[model samples]
Each structure stands twice: as C-alpha cells, then as structure tokens.
Target: MKKDLVKIIEDALKTLGIEKPTHIEIEIPQNESFGDMATPVAMILAATLKKPPKKIAEELVNAIKDKSVFEKIDIAGPGFINFTFSKKYIYSEIKKLMKDKSKFLREDIGKGKRVQIEFISANPTGPLHLGHGRGAATGAALSNLLEAAGYKVDREYYINDAGKQVRILGLSVFARYQQLLGRDYPFPEEGYRGGYIEEIARVLIKEEGEKYLKRAFDEVSDFFTDYSYKRMLSSIDSDLKDFGIAFDTWQSEKELYKKGDVEKALDDLKNRGLIYEKDGAAWFKSTAFGDDKDRVIIKQDGEYTYFTSDIAYHRQKVEKKYDEIIDIWGADHHGYITRVKAVIEAIGYPKEKLKILLVQMVTLLRGRKPVQMSKRAGKFITLREVIDEVGTDTTKFIFLTRRPDSHLEFDLEAAKAQSSENPVFYVQYANARINSIFAHAREKGIDTDMLYNADLKLLSVHEELRIIRKLLTYPMIFEGAVNAHEPHRITFYLQELSGMFHPYYNKYRVITEKSEQSRARLALCEAIRIVLQDGLEILGISIPEKM
Candidate 1:
C-alpha cells in the first residue's frame, strides 16, 4: 500500500516538471480523522522546486488522479497530503487476504539470509530470575519475527559453564551437603546462598552417598562443582522449556575452552597486533576500536578471562557464516557491547555483522508497589513462579509488550486479569468474537462458501472499510518489525488491530437478515479471525476460541 502511494506521488511530481527529491517520508497519521496515510513529500520538494509548500502540494494533488486505489487526496495541516483509499479498493484487499491469508502477512525483506540470535545466556549458578525471563521472551519473539520475515534464524543460549561463578555454585552445594550430613563447615562469603543450592546438594547426596562427602573439602568441592554446574544447567533448561523458550543450540563455555578455541583466538589477536603483554597479563587493544579501554584477555594467574572465551565464541559464530549475529544481553552488560563489537571487527569481520541488543530489567509490581529482587541476598522472584501465577502465554505477551531497551513495570494483577483490561485477553477476545460470527452464520444456515465467491464490491460499509484498512497495514507493520529487530511492535499492532475489529463488530451485523450481504460480512469476519490467529501465533500467544 505504501509503495503504491509512493509511486503515485512520484508520477505526479514528474508530470509537474519537478525532479524527484532525494527521499520522502510516509507515515500513518496520529489522528485518524486526518486520513489513512499522510506524506510530506511536497513540503520536502518545495525548496528544490522553488515553490511554496502549499503551492507544491496543490499542484501535486491536482496532478494525481483518484482513478485506482486512491479515493481522494487532500492537502491539510501545513502542506501535508492526506490519502483516503476507495472502499472498493480496500474490499479488494480483504478478498486478497482471504484468498491467500497465510502468505499475505509475510514480507520477503530478509531474502532468506541466515541469522543467529543468542539470548538468555544466564549463568548456571542459580535458577533463572524474572530478568532472565524477560530476555528469554524477547529473544524468542525476535527469532519468530525474523523467520516470519523470511529469514533463517537460529536461536541459541550460551552457557557460562566454566567460570568463577560456577566454582562458587559448586562450593555452595558442597557446604550444603556437609550441613545436611550434620558436619561443621564454613561456607565461603562469596559463594552462592540461594535455596536452590540445597536442592542440588540433596541430589548429590542421593547419587554418591556419604563416601563422596567424606572426601577432603577441596577435593569434594571440585567434584561437586562439576556435578552441580550440570545439574543447575539442566534445571534452567527445563524451566525455560516450561516458559515456551527452546534454544536451537546450547553452546558451553567450558566446551569451547576444552577445544582450545580460547587460546587460538588469543593467538590470532596477538598475530594481528591486537593483543599485548601488560602487567604480567595479556590485554586486547580494544580502545583502538572504540572501547573505553583495553580489556584483559589473560590474568596474572595464567587463566583466560570471560572476555577471552567470549571472543572465541564470537569467532566461532562468524566461522559458521551467519549473515548476522544478534546477542541479547542484560542491561548491566550494556558497557560490554563496544568491546565485543571491537573484537569482531579486529577478527576481520564487519562490525555491523554483530548486533548486541541490551534488554533492560523488568520491575515486577503489585499495583503501584515495586517488588525487589536481589540474587546475592537471595531475595528474588524466579521465572517459574511468574509462569505458575500467569500462564506462559500471558507471561510471554506481557514481557513483549514493551521495547526491550525500555524498563518494564509488570503488573501482576493486570497480567492475570480475565477482563478486557488485560491486553492479552483483549487481543484473544477479538479472535473469539470473530469465531462467534462463524457460529452464528452456521446456525442461520448461511453458507460461507458463497461469500468467498461473492462480489467483494458488496462490502462498502464504513465499518467494514475500517477493518479492511487495518488489515492492509499488516505488511508494513511486519516489515518495520523485522527491520528494527523488535517484536514488541507486533504486540502493539495486534492490540490496535483488535481494537479496530471490536468496534466494527459492535457497529455491524455479520448474520443479520441472512442475506447475501450477511454472508459476505461473515466471510470478512473469517478473514479477520485468521489473520489475528496468525499474528498471535507469531507472538507465541494462543487465540482462545472461547475467552
């Protein structure tokens, strides 16, 4: 629709003896009364053509005819051209939607490029908290959006299995095991103290018995560290699965280290003069590539830092030949983005190929009161608890309601609400209501097959035209969501689309009088329902047949 409008304007300019401008902006008007779409092309071309804005707009509008798609064009609000489409043209689009509903909503903007999005790489030291859940939902929705835009997407979770954090987790479990056996032990101050550590300790006690616990403190800690890391990772995986997030790959940091990729990446950096020896340690010259300062790759103890393993992991991703790599990290890691991109650039890869998306924290709220979460103090809300309180669909939808970069204040009552106040329920209700139209049609013995073949020209009602206009915007919405790599746009689009449908439903009758026009309206209702279902499916939300 936007393309057709642009071509019409371009043709009008050529006829008016005006050269095409460099660019033009077309956007939906904030005030629906303005028109369906408003363009500032004439205002932009005024300076180039040496004419006043209004003069240019008037001439352009006169040159453009309302022959095909456009019903009329008017210049309003400081030389902005507002476009209103003919009801017949919109009804034709609705027919197109019904004939090919599945493919109508998708755009080929990605051109089948391979993209890998790594997200929710939470450390295996503890269960996933609410923050991790937000990242998981965002990443999953992003992958679905990219695929819907015709890109091959790979979802991944990078596990920090080999780190000081895992060591602390192991020691925490060992201390709990000793306490469970009624032995005196002092747990390290820096170790994990979450209640989940006791669960891991119980599993260790059940599997290996007292003989394993009788070993020296250091030896048992080493054994428990390896066992507990795997156990915690498995538990995290299961929890995410319950939340409807499944990763195509679970790349382990420890596996990368064992494969010697970390050392190899460091050597490659050294060969490229990107690494240097400093203070008996190795550091990468990250500052040269726009980082705040050089980053340490190897410490004085001859152990690689987390940055070293991350460089290797990124290199491995590039070696896999992905057209783009998107890393979704928590907001606290925002400062780490520059260095990671610098490393990718230093490794002979384009910096644009690696995109780091930082997702802000989700602040859980009960009405106006904030719910505090702290991992170190063992005061936090687990993802499982959120999922249990609200179903996975509601949780995912609420998480995706806001942009990832914006902090979200999740209201528990709003999410679990069964009324129209909940955005998720409101959107699902639109689908249910559309299904009700079909049920009414069947009950009245009105055959819908005749409507599919009905002359779409019969659908010229103002309410029906409004629904068709909303449906026509799907492709543009999809393209924007894909280009921005933001799935929250789809959530917003779904809400707005549902709002348009509900009012239309209240104004018009789908099975009134059981005439041919009624059948046509019922067919339109079916098309709307299917498109809503498809949109909800992309967001991983269910369309309840009866809400």
Candidate 2:
C-alpha cells in the first residue's frame, strides 16, 4: 500500500517537472481528521523550488493521476497534503490480506541481502544466566524479523573453547572428581563453586570410577577439560533449544587456533604495518583506527591475547561474504566495541559494516523486592530455572518487553498472572477470543469464511473504521523495526493491537441480527487476528487458540 502511494506521488511530481528526492517521507496523521496518510513533500520542496508551499501543494494535487486511490486530497494549514484512502482501496487491501497473509505481509525491505548475527556466545564455564537469556531472546527475535523482511540471516554462536575459563571449569570438575573418589587433591583457588560442579563429579565417578585417580593433573588435564566443558555445552544447547533459539553456526575459538587462522590474521596485520614490537611483545596499532591507544596482540611470554582470536574470528566472518556482520554483546563489554571495530578496519574491512548491539543486564524481582541467588546455580539465577518456574513463553516475552540496551525489571508475579498485566497472556488471549467469536458465528449458522466476500463497505462505524485504519499501518511499523534491528517494537505493537481489539470486542458482537453488519464486522475481526498472530510469530511467541 505504501509503495503504491509513493509511486502515485512520484508520478505526480514528474508531471510537475520536479525531480523527486531520494526518499519522500510518508507519515500517518496523528489527528485522524487530517487524513489516512500525509506527506510534507511540498513543504520540503518549497524553499528550494522557489514557490509558495500552498501553491506547490495545489499544483501537485491538480497533477495527481491515480485519482481512484484516494477519496479526497485536501491541502490543510500552509501546505500539508492529507490523503484519505478511498473505501474501495481499503476494501481491496483488506480482502487481499484475508485471502493470503504471507504474500501480503512480507515486505521486500532486505532485497536478498545477507546478514550474519552472532550473539549469546557465552563462555562454557557454567549455566546461562539471565543476562545471557536476554541476548538469546533478542537474537532469536531479530533473526525472525530480518527473515520476515526478506533478508537471509545466519544465526551464529561462537564457542569460547580456547580460554582460561573452560580450563578452570575442567580443574573444578577434576578436583571434585578426586574428592568423590576419596583422594586428597586440593581444588583450584579460583574454581567454580556451583552445585553443578558436584553433579559433574558424580557423573564422572559413575562413568570412569578411579580411572584418573593415579594420573598426574597435567598428564590428564586435556581429557578432564574436554569432558567437563562438553558436558556444560550440552546443557547450554538444551536450555537454548527449550527457549526456542537454535543457531545455524557454532564457530569454535579452539578451531580458529587449530586452523592457524589466528597466526595468519596476525601476520596480515604485521604486513599492513599495523603491528609493532614493543618491549619484546607484539602490539597492534588500534589507535590508528580510532582506539584510544594501541593494544597488545601477543605478550612478551609469546601468548596470544584474547583480542587476537577475536580479530581472526571477525576476519573469517568477513570472508564469508555476508553484507553485514552483527555482534550482540552485554553491557559489560561496552568498551570492547571500538577496539574490535578497529581490528576489522586494520584488516581492510569497512568498519561500518560491523554493527554491535549491547544488551543491558536483567534484574529479577518477586513483586517489588529483589530476588537473589539460585538454589541450582548457587550464585546467580539460571535461564533454565526461570523457564522451569514460569514458562518458555513468559520468559521470552518478558525478556523482550524492554529495549535490549535498557534496564529491565522482570516481576515474577506479574509474569505469572493470567490478567492483562501479563503481556504474554494479554496477546495470547486476543487470538483465543477471536476464535471464540468465529465459533459463536458458526453456532448461529453464520459462516465466517463467507463473510470474506461480504460488502465490507458496511464497516462504516467509527470504531470499525478506526480498527481498519490501525490495521493497515502494520507495514510501516514493520519497516521501521527492521531497519533499526529492534524486535521490542513488535512486542509493543502486538500489545497495542490487542489492547484495541479487547475493548472493541467487549462492546460489539460479531454475529448480529443485521446480516450485512455482522458480516463486515466478522471480516474486521479476522483481519485483526491475522495481524496479531503475524506479529506474535515474528517475536517467536506461541499463539493459543483458547485461553
């Protein structure tokens, strides 16, 4: 619908001997009395074209060729052209929407561009905490949103298997295993202290018994580290799966080292004169690309810094030919963005092609008081525990209720409520209520499907037309959300659409004594259901047909 309107306006400008701007902004009039859609193109072109704004508006209105698309084009105030869409046009669009949702709702905003989004690549040291859960939910919804907008997206998770964190996890399990076997070995000073460690120890005892009791720690360190992390990673995969997030790629940090990509990337930087030797250590000239100072890529002890592997990983991602690379990191990693983008620039990739989003930490509360400590994790709450307590739908919906970069206070009782306070319940109930309407229509021997052919012009009441007006603006909302890479927009939109429908439903009946009125209203209700379910699906939330 927007595309058609833009074309009409462009053609009108061509007739007036004016070259259109690259983007002619179309807006929905906040005051319904203005029109359905309004554009300030005349106001924008006035000073440059050397014509009065009202005269230009009049000339464009007189020049419009697609007269059937509008009921009337009025010049209000100084030069604003307000367009009220003809009822015939609105009926055609609503009919097309009810006939086929997929072809109607899917916009071509991406135009086949490929995007690589890497997120929630948490260390395999323990269960995923709430912070990780927020990233997971955002990543999953962003992937769905891009796909709906016609982009080919690769959802990825980078495994941090080549770090000290995983080694500590191995030592923790190794120490716990020895103790469970009656050995007197000491635990690592900074080992993880969660109850999950003891569970891993029991599993190792049940499987291997005292097989490693007589071996030196260094001799069997690889086996213990590999077994322990792999176990933790399995649980991670399961938890994410239950949360409705599955990644297309699992790039391993260890694989980057094993394949010599890290060494090759460092050599590339050195060849480009971005690497320098300082005090027997190799330093990267990150400041050359906007960093506050240069950073060390290799220490004097000949060990690679954490940033070294990150450079290799991003270099590899660029080689995959994705048009855009997106990294979703936590707020704690705020300062890390500039340095990472600097390495990408040093490696000859455009820094702007790399987009990084930071998700703020989540604060869990029971009503107003803060709830701390998880019985299972022994330190912080686990994503799995939250899912087990509330539900998969509530956990996901609550995480997405706020912008990922903003602080979110998730109330446990509010999320579990069955009333409108629970957003998930509110949105889900809208679809369920629509189903009941159709069921009631059938019980009265009124076929709702046949209403699709009804004279929808009978939907002339203020409230019915108001719902239609709101329903037709979905594409604009979707385009804005997609271009901004924000999925919380969809959550907020679903709530508003449901909010509109629930009040209207309480006062109106879908199956009335007047056959024509009932038919037109039933068609309106079905369109609302289609759009509500469509937005919910983009957020990856379930649509319940019954409360």
Candidate 3:
C-alpha cells in the first residue's frame, strides 16, 4: 500500500515536470483525524527547488493523475500531504491480504546475497558467561531476520584455541591433577581456580591412571591443553544448543597457524608494502588504511601476536565469497575494530564489507535487588546456571530485550512472573487468549477456519480499523530490524502489539458468531495470532497455546 501511494506521487511529479526526491518519507499520522498516511515530500523538494512549500504542494496535488482510491487529499501545515483511503479501497486491500498474505508480509530485499556472521566465539579456557549468551541470542535472531528478508546467511563460531589462555588452562588442570595424585606441584598464579578444574583432573585420573604421572610437566603440557580446551568447548556447545542456538561452522584459530595462513597473509601484506620492519619487529602499516597507529604483527622473540591470527581468519572468511561478514565481540574488544577493518581494506576489500557489533556487560537481578550468587565453577555466573534457574525461553527473551551495545539488567524473578510486568508473559497470554477464542467458536459449532476468509467489510468499528492498521506495520518493523541488525526491535513490537490486543479482548466478546460481525472480529484476532507466532518464531522463541 505504501508502494502504491509512492508511485502515485511519483507520477504526479513526472506529469508536472518536477524532479522527485531520492526518497519519499511516508508515515502514519499520530492523530487519526489527520489521515491514514502522511508525507513531507513537497517540503523536502521546496528546499532544493527554491520554491514555496505550499505552492509546490498545491502544484503536485493538482497534477495528481489518480485519486479514485482516496477519500480526500489535503495539504496540511507547512506542506505536509495527508492521504485518507476510501472505505471501499481499504476493504479491498484487506481482502487482498486475506487471500495473499505473502505479498504483504515481506519483500526479497537481499536478492540472493550471501552473509556470513561469526559470534560468541568465547575463549575455550573457561565457561561461557552471561555476555556470551547475549551475543548468541543476538546473532541467532539477526541471522533469522536476514534469512526472512531473503538473504542466505551462515552462522559460525571461531575458537580462540591458539592462545596463552589455553596454556594457562592446561597448567591449572595439571596442578590439580598432581594434587589429586598425592604430588606437590605449585599451581600457576594466573591459572583458572574453578572447581571444574578438579573435575577435569579426576576425569584424567580415571582414564590415564598415573601413566603420565611420573613424566616431566613439559612432556605432558600439550596433552593437558588439548584435553581441557576440548572439554570446555564441548560444554559451551551444549549450553548454546540448549539455549536454542547452533552454528553452521566451527572455525579453529589453531588450524590457521597449522595451515600457514598467517604467513600467507603477512606475505600478501609485504607485497602490498603494508608490512614494515621497525626496531627488530615486523609491523603492519595499519595507519595507511585509517588505523590510528601501526601495529606489531610479530615480536622480536619471533612469536606472532593475536592480531596476526585474526587477520588470517578474516581473510579466509572473505575468500569464501560471502557478500558481507559480521563479527560480534565483547565491548572490551572495541579498540580491535579499527585495525581489523584496516586489514579488510589492505586486502583489497572495502572496509564496509566487514561489520562489527559489540555486546555490553550484563548484570543479573532477582526481583528489584541485585543478584550476586557465586558458583563453584567461576567467579561470575555461568550462562548454564541462568538457564537452569529460569527456563530457556525466559532467559533468551530477556537477553534480547536490549541492544547489543547496551548494558542489560536482567531480573530473573520478573521474567518468571505471570503478571503483566513480564513482557514475555504478557505477549504470550494474548496468544493463548486468541487460541481460546477459536476453541470456544468451535464448541459453538462455528467453523473457525472459515473466519479467515470472512468479509473484512464487517470490521467497520474504529478499534477494529486501528488494529488492522497496526497489523500493517509489521513488515515495516521487520525491514527496519533487518537493516539495523537489531533483533531487540522485534521485542519492542511484540510488547506494543500485545498491549493493543489485551485491551481489545477485554472490552469485546467473541464467539457470539450468530452475527457475521462476531466472525469478522474473531478473524481479526486470528490475524493477530498469525503475526505473534511469526515474530516469536523468527526470534527463535516458541509460542504457547496455553499459558
């Protein structure tokens, strides 16, 4: 419907020999008396065309070729044009929606473009924290939204397996294992001190049983490192899967070093003159591509920095022929973005081809007070613990209620409430109410499915029309979320749509279907259910028929 109106406006501009603006902004007026849709295209053109906005608006209105569908067209304050559709036209459009909803639901904006997103690739040294869970939720939902918008999206997890942290993890577990075997070995000062370390040590004792116990620590370091990290990575994968997320690929940083990708990437940069030797260390000229300073890729000790492997991994991702790449990282990695983007430009890809989103910190709350529970596993709470306390659905929904870059205060008690204060509960209760209405209609011997094809003209009340108009805004919400790469927008819409529904259901009684008016209103309720189910599913949430 917006496209149809924009076409009419464009035709008028063409007929009057006036240049059209690049974009025509159309919105639903807050004041229902103004019109169904309002635009300021004339005022926009007035600034560029050097004419009075009122005069331009009148000229465009006079030249309009078709006004048959409009009840009236009026120029309001400061050259804003308002359009009110005729009743016949509005009903005809709703009828079209009933018969062909796919046409009204979404457009194929991506046109077969491929997108690759890597997120929540937590270090294998420890358990996943709440921040990682937030990234997982955001990435999964964003992937769904892009796919719904017709983009082929692949999700990935990049493992930071080749790092000092894993070495620390190995030493941490080795000390615990020695202590369990009655040997006195000093633990690393910066080692992981969690109870899970003891668990891993016990597992090793049950398997190896003192076979490698007498060997030097140096001889068994690699075995301990590989075993500990793989165990933690398995735990991370299980938690994510239980939380309703699964990645298409698991990329290993260790593989990059083994395959000589780091050397290949450095050689490519050296040929481009972006690699320079400075003070006995090899430095990357990142400033040539907008980084604030050059960075050292290799130390004087002949060891590669973390940045070297990062560059190689991203280069491999680009070589996969994806149209775009998205990386989600913790907010602490903010400074790394510029250098990584510089690497993209240095490798002949545009900086815009790579996008990064940051996940901020999360604070847990119980009721109105703060939650400060310590697990024996880690100092901070684990994502698994949260999911265990609250159900998976509550945990996921609360995680997505804020933007990726915004700090979130998740209240475990509030999320589990059955009251209106709980956003998920409020929205899902409306879905349950709708289903209950259908069930009642069926009990009265009314064919509930037939209501889907009911005459929408019977829905003439103001509240009914308002609900219909709100329903029409869903596709707009979906498109906006896809463009902004924010899944929280869907949560906001869910609250607003449910707020509209509960009040309407309270004031009106359905299943009085002796009159077709009741059937029409019941059909409107079904339409609301359709949208709620779709929105929740796209966010990887389940719908409850009863709550």
lDDT: which candidate is best?
A: 2
Model 2 poorest 10 in a row by lDDT: 412-421
> Model 1: which residue pairs collide?
none
Better of 1 and 3 by TM-score: 1
lDDT at 339 for candidate 3? Answer: 97
* Per-residue lDDT over 171-193 for candidate 2, one digit per residue giving the tens place of the 0 to 100 score: 99989888888889897878998
Pick by lDDT: 2 or 3, better one: 2
| lDDT score, candidate 1, position 111 | 88
User: How do the residues 188-281 of candidate 3 rate in per-residue lDDT, one tens digit apiece?
Assistant: 7788888788899899999989876756778999999999999889988999989899899999999999999988999999999999998999
TM-score of each predicted structure versus truth: 0.95, 0.94, 0.94
| Model 1: lowest-lDDT 10 consecutive positions | 413-422
Better of 1 and 2 by TM-score: 1
Summing lDDT over every window of 10 consecutive residues in candidate 3, give the lowest-scoring window: 371-380
RMSD of each: 2.1, 2.3, 2.4
lDDT of each: 0.85, 0.88, 0.85
